[model samples]
Target chain A: MTTQASVAPLDRAPAPETPFFFPSGDRPLYAVHHAPVAGRANAPVVVHCHSLGVEQVTCYRAEVLCARAAAAAGFPVLRYHARGHGDSAGDFADATLARLIEDALAAAREALRRSGATHVIWLGVRFGALVAASALPLGPPAAGLALWEPVQSPRDYFRAQLRGLLYSQVAEGRKPTETVDDLFARLDRDGAVDVHGYYLHRALADSVRDVTLARRLETWNGPTFLAQIEQRRSLAPAHAALAEALAARGAKVETMRVPEEPGWHMVANPAWTSPELVAATAEWLRAVA
Target chain B: MPWRESAADLDRARAERPIVVPSAFGGLVGIYTPAAPDVPSAGLCAVLLTRPRSHRNRMWVEGARRLAAQGFACFRFDYHGTGDSEGPTGPLDPNRPYRDDIVTVLRVLRAQLGGRRFVLCGACFDARTALSAFADEADAIAGLMFMAAPVVELDTLVRVDADRKDWGHLARSLRNPYNWKSLASAGRWRYMATVIGRVARRSLGAAPAGDPPLGAAFVEHFQALLRSRARALFLYGRDDAEYESFRIAERTAFAKLTPEQRARLEVEVWDGTVHGFLEMKRQRETFERALGWIAALHPARAAAPARTIPGDATPSAVAG
Candidate 1:
């Protein structure tokens, strides 16, 4: 047994990535700061916004992989659990798009201060990407933004989540006593509805559904990198359409379509990592830097 | 305790540094330790929260903090391969019967914080691991909390899954005739045929027996645990059918236990909740119940009791 008394209490070596909890409100947000190695002393720090619920659970390993790769490529990174998510304070049911944006802004400022980086770049995946876009105003003198398979519409995403919940209930031989309309009504009446295991509040649903990234992408004039993952041969039409729209807005956009299974959904396999995705991301950050 | 780091120091360091738990397996495992209590109390009790098989330590992070706020020391760690722990990725093996990781963590807690009375809490499959680990040293644990622990018969589980899927198919077809209409198409029929075949294979006689039944050993451990008079809490979701299957298995196992042994067990089922206590309100209630039980089992004259249970707030204190 490795007891504290038995093992020599040698101090841990200074790691490039320093983990800490930063203030948000009543509960502090859990965050990790990946300091750039010696060579990139003045590198731009990237703040990572994680995906929601099950996606966050499964893609954690991938997120770690991506952070390490980014750090190796000389980008100091700050990845945090937003309020009501991960190690952060507050209940998941109380989460709102506004609160998430506020939390992201706080994380970016903390990262910039701690890493001594001049600029903040928001790197987000899935719903996290949408948050990054919405939080753009909070991070001033933005270096760039990276969006990975960002959710096109919050309403559509929530609907899909509801379908999964229904399918599971049915698969388990129990009929979900509530329908989609019933859930919306419950959210309106009770201010919250339990979907799967997450508590979805009316305020959160209403605010998130109003978020349209296609309309907001032009607001971010900084260099942008958008990567989409696809299971089949061709890129998803929605992703292509997004890339075209960003380009039309006169934004410097670099789009890449990596053919691979969605890592966020594969929770069983913890070691699942998309080498191509990580490589493409690192390369894009290098080009932009 | 003079040789160990204080909780306040740990907290200060945590705010500025990454905290890693040293593993017996030659590498550091990632851990989220709640800030140690400001004033160290005598006979300080600590809780070690383990993951649900595939999940990392994040599931128990919030609960750990709640326990810490209540003046108990808490540690949430990723087992060797999962989370940020240093090890090759793979499922935790319950059969191998070795838990050097858990022992190492306990030893660290005892040595560092003077935490003598420890509570081992596990969710789902991890409950079995915690139980097995505590069985060897029953004298050490103050309590054991099992959340959605699976002690179900394999055949029962398979049947339940098939029945549920069948009901789902029927309900959908009834609700939307288009579902039945789609079955008229060749592709839909083939899909339906595949589903039927799969279900048939999983049935008791047709399916290949994979894992050996936990059988008498599962009950034996509990009996031994209760003989030692350690408190045990079984919290499951009322809506979970799989847990119902586990309850059936438990009934058979508990039939042999003495009433005295059964008296040590406490079970709580949250109505309208899912398997993992996914909703925040339910999670809070579950934590509150756990706090109440922990307080009652090892009541501290100095500490304040948790919030009162309004009517059904109290967990059913059933005799085994």
Candidate 2:
């Protein structure tokens, strides 16, 4: 048996990634910083806001790959878990959309401070894109925005999530005893509903339901990259409209439709990657930088 | 006692530290939650493994926190090529455990945590990995907590896939005369024929070729675990197909165990629980049961009382 006082030293050198906890109010948000590769400086630091629930798990690998790619291309990248998510301190049941936005802004500031960069770019995947966009007018000025399959309508997203809960119930061989309306009622009565292991809180549900990205995002005209990740070739109508709206407000908008699996929900491959998505985003980052 | 601390102090009690341990692939990213200082340390560390497709956050982050609160230092990490860990991702075989990555984590824990016996916990594919790791590092492991582990390797996956693809649809279709006609189509007929053939072979007391009895390796590892000093708790949802398969396959082996080995092993099948325990209610039940089992392992060292989840009755014990 080993003694409590004897600590063994690490045999290997430190990895390029640095994981730490930064404060978001009294609670701490977990974050990992990937330093820009050798001698690169003054490039806009990238702060990543991840999606909520299972989508976060599904897109985790892709997010890591994208962050590493950006870091290799001379941009310092910071990937963080919003409060009440991942290793962060808080219960998922208490997490609100507003709180998530606050966490994103905090991450952006921390990334800029750590990298000593003049500005920051927000990179968000799925619902995270909505968060990044939501934080735009509320924060430290962003140099650019990169959204991968952003959720344009929160109401539709919540409905889909509720449908997913029902689907899971049926998939587990249990006859779903409640309808979508009944679930909403339960959410109202209990203030939260379990949606495939994640707690969908009423506050979050209400806030998300009220958000219409195109109408709500009225300020800040920065360079933006919109990636429509799906099997089909065309940009989603809602996304195309959001891109047009951003352009209308003097933001330089570039949209790419990557023909790939929408990894935010269901993924067939565990090590799934979208090289095209990464490559295009990197190019966009370089251009904006 | 640490459990009597103020809300603020209790909130500050748990500190999640992120660590990167070097592996063959590169670095494996993990979060380590040390046992609360105010609590009596069990001198044991729990290593939580991630399911193949899911990240560590699935149900593990909260689990680690809960364990840490109960005086067990806990670590949960992403396997190389998954989550934030660096490596080239490739197709993973369900039968093949990620032994190398698991061993790497174990070594790091032994080095960093020091002087602590480890409890290996995992679910589904990861449960198999934990069992394999326990068999390989028996001396270092004090206990094993497995949820819905496959007694017969790859069998659960096959059943889950079949359930998703055919069983439900087939059962529903069989009730309708019109659907029976559609089921007689070439593709459907081929699938049904294969199933019937397998059933016929089983009835004739002939095992399928290439399908070893009770998964030879799993049985070997399990027997090794039983012979060791380490204790184990196996929890399964009654509805999970693996539950029935495990009960049928491991019956003889479990029956032949010595009283001492049986005393150290436990098996529980809960009512209305699914394979993943995806619902919060079921997850809480699992965590409470697991925590209770862990606490019972070393009662003198346990710092807090095992929390009882409401509405969870006594689980039906299949063994021990």
Candidate 3:
């Protein structure tokens, strides 16, 4: 039989509000597909990618804002639940860049078919940004992407996710091994992160670890937005640095720092949550769409 | 490894039945009972309900609906540091800080009633909490009902005695950082109690009297609790897998009592019903049935004809 020998480009179709399901790991991938309620539907289709963990819930505020912004600006948006996410089925440990890309492609193709949106765009936050960068199809007739807090270094993102759970375990005074990598293989074998309940697997962890969004990014992808939050703590120098690189390669790069608010990664502080970020992204998508 | 979202499951869960239970330390940090009875009676006002480790609150609403149909206002609240009320799920505060709130609520209910015979009812451990804290000198609380009384069952880990699937959470929760550290000495009575509670649930059953001493009890001593203050009624469902065993074991041990011990005890069962009678629709119907059982125990105290009217009232209508 045929293995994963070649990339099968996705053929996705969209309906008024029907969720497009992509074949992901022996199950259909389902997502809530929202189109512009008001006008002709031939708008840019933006595949909105979501963040990881609790932040995923937190990011719903942003996703809704962005979708409305796009829909208002005549863009039909398709949001797909990645495998092991939402209605999509598969073990969480099986969540790799490959499935994520498959999920995005499936969603994007569906949006194109359903709305006749000629251009596809990628909009993401945090881990969503990293995945979008890692898996955005490489070719001509491509979609532009706008990312917020792309963990510039894969090492740092891995550290945050793994450490947040394991450290909580250790903080509870339970014995934890020296580092998360030590438990990664063991936990992956268990198909669970043991502490955090996130799916863990060798392949998925490797895909996440290997993604250095800055190095992987290039020009020709067209108008890129590298949104940052500044306070003395800039998450990754690589993010700003990548913007500079894309600009150097003749791609239009815009660096906008949300100066007054705390980073989305840290939400324990109630005041740090900025509804303004939601407002701005919505406005930005409206203008672009 | 990357974590995937449980979006569809959450959607289904939300659509089917939405419920929120904070962790031991979740929610607003306060325990509140219903306000003082001075507030104008709205003919069965809604009362905020809470109690310690309250799976029994499931039956409280069942009881509330019975009284509500007759236009009575009552509320059951969680203990200061227990259940859905707030501040730490367990590690039950020995000082019982929440007792003040319970006292305050009862006083308010007393003041509000203006001698209208306000009633207070509790299921499981809440009944014990009510009896200990707010049992006297009230125009309200004309009647007290304790369903599936907590005294006998509280002796065992709920995991062993109740239909609580949430026992897994308790078992995991008891592994709380504070509990683990306290048990380091391994010989302390406090440590023993903690260990016993956890191990009791983990073990299939058969916890001994000396097993870590969380107010350990003898079979003979437990029966003395049959004495009721305000014509107490004990109602349970026969179909409930958990209470069926609990009822059988309790009634057997209770039956062995002397005539004096048997006099104050009155028990009734709803055949083919689960703990809380969750399988039945129309919770009021289940409650009215229970009320009929309770009313039968005190023919003189009865307010209504002990009759249930079908198609006359819905749950929402009763909530008002």
Which runs in model 2 stand beyond 4 Å of their true positions?
A: A1-15, A168-177, A259-272, B1-14, B51-58, B155-169, B173-212, B301-320
lDDT of 2 by residue, A94-123 (tens): 667888898888888888888888788888
lDDT of 3 by residue, B94-125 (tens): 12223355455555544644323434444434
Error of 2 at A156 (Å): 1.3
- The sequence of per-residue lDDT tens digits that candidate 3 reaches over residues A164-237 is 66656554456766587776666556654433323345566677665677666753446777677555355356
What's the lDDT for residue B130 in model 1?
Answer: 67
* Candidate closer to the true structure by DockQ (higher is better), 1 or 2: 2
True contacts kept of each: 0.23, 0.35, 0.03
The DockQ values of the predictions, listed in order, are: 0.19, 0.27, 0.03
Ranking by DockQ: 2, 1, 3
Better of 1 and 2 by TM-score: 2
Winning model by DockQ: 2
State the DockQ, from 0 to 1, for candidate 3: 0.03
Task: Give the alpha-carbon lDDT of every model.
Answer: 0.63, 0.72, 0.47
Model 3 CA deviation exceeding 4 Å by range: A1-26, A37-42, A53-55, A166-177, A184-192, A219-221, A229-235, A259-273, A286-289, B1-320
Q: In lDDT terms, how accurate is model 2?
A: 0.72
Candidate 2, residue B192: lDDT: 61
Work out the TM-score per prediction.
0.74, 0.85, 0.45
